[model samples]
Each structure stands twice: as C-alpha cells, then as structure tokens.
Target: PFPSVALVGYTNAGKSTLFNRLTGAEVMAKDLLFATLDTTQRTIRLPQGRPAIIADTVGFVSDLPHELVESFRATLEEVGEADLILHVRDIASPDSAAQAKDVEAVLEQIPTPDGKTRRILEVWNKIDLLEPETRETVVGQAERLAREGTAAAVSAWTGEGIEALRDTIASLIDDDPETQLTVEPHRGDLLAWLYANGRVTGRETDDDGRVHLTVRLHPAALGRLERLYPDVID
Candidate 1:
C-alpha cells in the first residue's frame, strides 16, 4: 500500500482545497466550515515516481464538542496512521495561528501507532490572499520552520509552492525502510497481498509459468513474505 499522509487543519482553513489540488479528486470543498465530516482518501503521485495515499479529514475546531469528537474517532485515527501530517493553514485567516494551535491540540489527543510522534510539516496555505510583502513574510516564517526542520508554504488554489511541498514529502517518505522483493507466479495469493500492502515496481511471467516481480514493501511485509516464499526469492 502507498504510504499515507493526512491533511489536517481547522475548519475552512483550505485543507479540502489543498487536498483536491494534490489528489485531483472532487470530495466537496466549500467556503463554509466543516465541509468534510468524514475522512476522505485519495492517491497522490509524487515527482519522485513514488505514490502516497492522502487522507482529508474533518476540520478541527476550538473547544470541539465531545459528541462530535467521539463520532469522528475512526476518521481522526487516520491522522495517527499517517506517515506524515500536512498541517494546512489559511495564512490569511485572522485566527490562523490560533487555529493551528487548536489543530495541534486535537492531534495530540490521538494515539500514535508504535508510539512514534507523527511527523508534521506545516503548510502555510492561501498565500495568494496575502499582500506581496506579507506573502514574503509568511514564506519567510514557513522557511524558518524548514530551517529549524519543520514546515512549508503554498497556495493550493494557485498551485504556488506545491512543487517544494511535494519534494519535501518525497524526501520524507524515501527515508522510511523500504525493500525490493521478488515473487513467483504460483504465489498469486502472496503477490496479491504484496500488491495491496506494498508498491509493485515491475512484474513479468516466464514461459515456465514462474513469475518475476519487483516490489517495495515495508520490513514487516517483507519478513512475512520471506517466511512464506523461501524458494521464490533470491
């Protein structure tokens, strides 16, 4: 499976717009708050030829209601499962900073997998709405995060700074443990499982009915496959 990255932020913070821009999917983006009530997932292809799964979740709010929060636990769990977190913010929003803080608070409440702190890259979004000087200032602030090792800025509507964001995501995902594995034809069940849980790079079937497959899988999947198909791999 493709690695996942979640787009999170306060309601009406342009998270949905950015999600649409990145995934080319239509999942209902509007100017109103809380446009998304559930988690929506789509596939994204990065410039480095690697693919990732992007999840757009319900927008967060300050002092969120317990009922609402409880109802969205499964959706919020998507954030915990993410390989990366794109903290999208509407830079022009007067409460942008406060909104970001609120988002951070909600994220803190979620349980992370493997006890690993979710890697977050703040995205100071909606730059097109800012004045030139303000835009530069915001960019500088976001660049400071990069300097200190954390954030990025972009205008999802205008597609500005998207390339930089994509590149950063590529770098982050590449740093994870990924191994190339080869599979045999008769192991169709294993092959299917690998394709579902890993990224297949190449596959071919020989005249002898053996299959040749190249895949990039997480260490866990690789280990399971090895235990199951010792005779098929090199």
Candidate 2:
C-alpha cells in the first residue's frame, strides 16, 4: 500500500480539477457548489515514479451542519487518514483567504489516523483565472512559498505550473528505496504488477527466459512482492 494524499478545500475551489489533473481521473469538476459529495480515490505516479493513492473528498463549507458532517463521516475520514493534506484554494476568488481559513477550521475537527493533524501544503489553484499582472504577482508568491516548502501554484484547467506541483508532492513523500529483481518469463503477471505498482527504471531479457528489472518501490509494495516471489527478488 502506498501513502495516500487527500485534497481538501472550500466548495468550488478547484479541488476536483486538481484531483483530475494529478490522477487522470474523471470526477466531476463544476463551477457550482457541492459538485462532489462522496469521496473518490485514484492511483497515480508521483514525479519520482512511486505510486500513491490520491483521494478527493467533499468540499468544505463554512459552518457546515453537524447533520451533514455525520452523514459524510466516512468521506471526511479520508482526510484524517491521508499521509499528506493538500489545501486547495481558489487563488482568484475574492474570498480565497477566508476560504482557506474555513478549510483549516474543518481540518481542526477531524481526528487524523495518526491522532494529529497532518502537515498541509497549500495548493494555490485556478491561476488561469487571474489577470496578467495579478497572475505574475501570484506566481511570484507561489514560487516563494514553494521555496519554503509550504505551497504550490497551478492552473488545473490550463496545466500551468503543474509539474512543479507534482515535484513538490514527490519530494514530500519520497522515503522509499529502489531494488533490483529477476523474474522468469513464466511469471509475466508479476512483471505487470511491478509495472503497475512500482517504478521500473530498466528491464532486460536474457536468452534463459529471465527478466531483470531495476525498480523503485514503496516499502509495502516491496515487502509484498518479496513475500510473493521470494526467490525472484535479489
């Protein structure tokens, strides 16, 4: 199992857009409120080539009703269990700062899996909607924040500054180590699983029907593979 990332923000803040941009998922991203009610999970490769689970949860609303919170307890729990929390904000919105405050307020009420609030990285999204001069100012601010390792600025619609955002995520959760493995041709299934779950840097086939691979895998994936193909992994 890979570490999970949860996207959290106020309603209509482009959290869903960023989710789709990062994971290639098709979750609805609309201009209206409450577009996504339930939580959605998707697998994606980090910039460093490690696989991870990315989750998009229902948007946060100021003074959210206790009844609705209770109704979506399961969905909101995903935020608490996340290894990383991305606070997506609509930078172009007039209430962007207030929206961020609201998101933080909701996060405070969550009981995280680790019994503490996870570290949050601000995602200043919707830069595409900014005016030229304003966009330049915002971009500079984002760059400064990124240098401090606190935020990333991006346009989910126009795909601007997305690579930088991905790199930031990769740097945050990149504690996994690389390993080499050798599998027989008959174990094609294993090869496919490795490709899907790990980052395969190189592969070669020998005349003896052996496939050699260099891969970077999360510890959980590495352990599982070792257990399944003990003799194959070096």
Candidate 3:
C-alpha cells in the first residue's frame, strides 16, 4: 500500500499551503489560524514514483483547547496512523522554536498503536518570506539536517525545495521492504482490502478465477495480511 503522511504544525504555520502545493488540491489555504478544522487527504506521487496518501490536519496551538482536542479525535488520529509525520514550521516566524514545542507537546498525547514512536521529519517552511542571506543560511541548515534524515526546508508559496521534500519522504518510505502475495480468486473482500491498504501494481485473473497480485505494502500492513491469510502468502 502507499504510505501515509500527516502534515502537522502550529496554527498559521503554512501546513495547508504546503498541502495544497504538494497535492495540487484546492482545499482552503487561508492565512487565518484554525482555518482548517477537518482533515483533508489526497493521493500524491513521491519523487521515487510511488504513490502515497497525504493528510492536512487542523493546526496546533499552545495550550490547545481540551474541547477541540476531544472533538477532533479522528483528525488527530491521522497523525498517529501516519507512516511519517511532517512537522511544518514557519521558519520565518520569530517564535518558531516555541511553536515547535507546542506542537511536540500535543504529539506526545496522541496514541500510536504499536507503542512505537512514529518517524518525524521537520519541515522548515516559508523560506520564500526570508531575506536572501537569511534564506541561504536557513536552507543550508535544513539541507544538512536532511542529509541526516531529519529535516527539509521549503517555500509552500513559491515551490522552493519542494522536490527535495518529496525525495526525502520517498526515501523514508522506501526504507521498508514490500511483500508479494498470490491469493485465490473470487475473494472480493480480500481484493478490495488489498487495494485500500496497499499499492496494487498488478492484478490478473486466470480461467479458474484465481487472482495474482503484486502489491507494495508497508511492513505493518504486510504483517497484518500475513496473520489474516498465512496460507495464501508465497
């Protein structure tokens, strides 16, 4: 299956803008805080030719209201279920570090199913708003962090460094090995499940209705399938 990525950050940090820029979708990307109250997801192609699901979530804030957190459980859960978390930051903002702390505080409260920490990549966004010298310095720093597989700098508005961000995400997703399986035909439910949970690249049905599938699945999804249909796996 295609990997999932969740975009999370402080309010007005340009997550929506980056989301739109990356997915080419027109979901509202306003300058106002909390403009995106619901989660929006779109299919995007990673730099390495694999597709992925990318979600834009409501913005975070310091001391996030308990009521809102309770109401937005589903949206927040997307962050927990994501294969990768992109912590979008307004690098041009003076309070960027403090805002990042606020985001980190909220992330800690989310539940991860496997009791394992999710991989996070810092996205230092809005470099287009920086001055020439400052942009150079910030971009250089981000590039160094990216080399270590930790961060990327981009201008959601101007498309700066976006390709590099895509590449980074693809590299991270590809770090896992995918599984291959052939299953019996006429199992509509199983076929549908495979399409929904993984990237199905090939499918064929022979005269007897047997199905052969080539799917690219994350390790977790592969494990789930293995448990469910151990006999079918080959």
Candidate 4:
C-alpha cells in the first residue's frame, strides 16, 4: 500500500478543495456543508515524485450525532490507517479554532491497530479569505507551529504555501522506517508495486540481464513486496 495522508477538518474548511489540489482529482468540492460524506481516495504525486494515497473524508462537526459518526466508520478508518493527517482548517472562518478542536475530538475516537495515534500536521487553510492583518497573524501562528513542530499553512484555493506543506510532508514520510527499500528488475511485480507506492529514484540495467532499482516505499508495502519477490533485491 502507498503511504496515506488523511485530509480532515470541519465542514466547508476547504478540505475537499485542498484534496483536489493535492491529488489532481476532481472530487466534489462545494462550499455547502457535507459536500463530502464518504471517504474519497486518490493517488497523489508529491513534488519529489513519490506517490502517496490522499484520502478526503467527511467533514467533522461539533456535537455530531453518534450514528452520524458511526456511519462514517469506513471513512474514518482511513485516518486510523494513515501515516499522516492533514488537519485542514479554514483560517478565514471565525470559528476556525473551535472547528479544529472539534476535528481533534473526532480524531481522538479513531482506534489504530497498534494503539498509537497517527501523526497530525495541522494545516491552516483558506488564507486567501483573510485580511492582510489577520493573514499576518495567521501566518505568524503557522510559523510558530512550525517552530514548535506541529503544523503548517496554505491557501488551497490560490495554491499559496502549498510547496512548503508538500516539502514538510515529504520530510515526515522520509523519516518513516518502512519507506526505505531496494529492488532488482527480475521482480517485475515488485517494481510495479514500488512505482505505485513510492518514487523510483534510480534504476540501472546490468549486462547480466539484471535490473537494479532504488525506491523509497512505505515499510508495510516494502515488506509485502519483498515476500512476493524474494529474489528481487540484492
């Protein structure tokens, strides 16, 4: 499986817009509430050429009904299984902070298989709607979060600050132990899997009919591919 990042936030927070921007997928990103009710998964190519699975989930709401939350189990499960969480927030909204808190509360209820919470990267989005002074304040807060090692900022609508966010995510994913892998050409399927799950950095073909490939992939995917193609790696 490819490394996954979950786009989560309160309704109308631009999570879906950001999802479309990052993945280049055409999911419905309306300004209305609950525009996205189910989890939508799309393959995204990072700036570094690495592949990641980006999932856009239903927006979280304060005082949301238990049944409503439960109905999104399959969608929420993506969060539990993700390697990173993009906590998208509407920086322009007056209740943005409160909405973020609501999202956090919902995230708290997601159960992971290893009993460990996913890494969350707070993303203050929609800066295009903020005034100059408020934008400065919001940008300062985002910088502070970066300094404190917690979050980042971006304008999904205008594509501002997106490069920084992508770089940050790339760094985080690179730190994961599961993403390092080596492959040889004999394992065509493993090569395909690597291409799907990670970025292929280098490849060379030897005179002896062997192909060598260097890839950075999620650990789970690497392990599974290795088992399927034991002779692929030297």
For each candidate, give its TM-score against the true structure. 0.79, 0.85, 0.78, 0.82
Give per-residue CA lDDT, model 2, range 1-234, as digits (tens): 787899999999899989998988788998766789888999898775678889998998888877877788999888888888999999999999998888888887888765655878899999989999999999999899897678999998888989999888877766568788988889989999998888787889999989999987888888898798777778
Writing each residue's lDDT as its tens digit, candidate 3 over 1-234 gives 567899999999999989999999998887777899999999997753577999999999889877778788999999999989999999999999999999998998888879656999999999999999999999999999998879999999999899999989888776556556676766787887777677676778778888888777777888888787677666
| TM-score comparison, 2 vs 4, better candidate | 2
lDDT of 2 at 26: 88
Q: What global local distance difference test value does model 3 have?
A: 0.87
- Indicate the TM-score of model 4: 0.82
Residues 1-234, model 4: lDDT tens digits? 567788999988999989988877889988777889888988777766877778899888897777877888888988988988888988889998788888888888878878655788989898889899989998988988876547888999899988888878876666534333445446667667767766776777777756666676666766776787675555
Instruction: Give the clash total for candidate 1.
Output: 3
Which window of ten consecutive residues has the lowest lDDT sum in model 4? 176-185
lDDT of 2 at 170: 75
RMSD of 2: 2.7
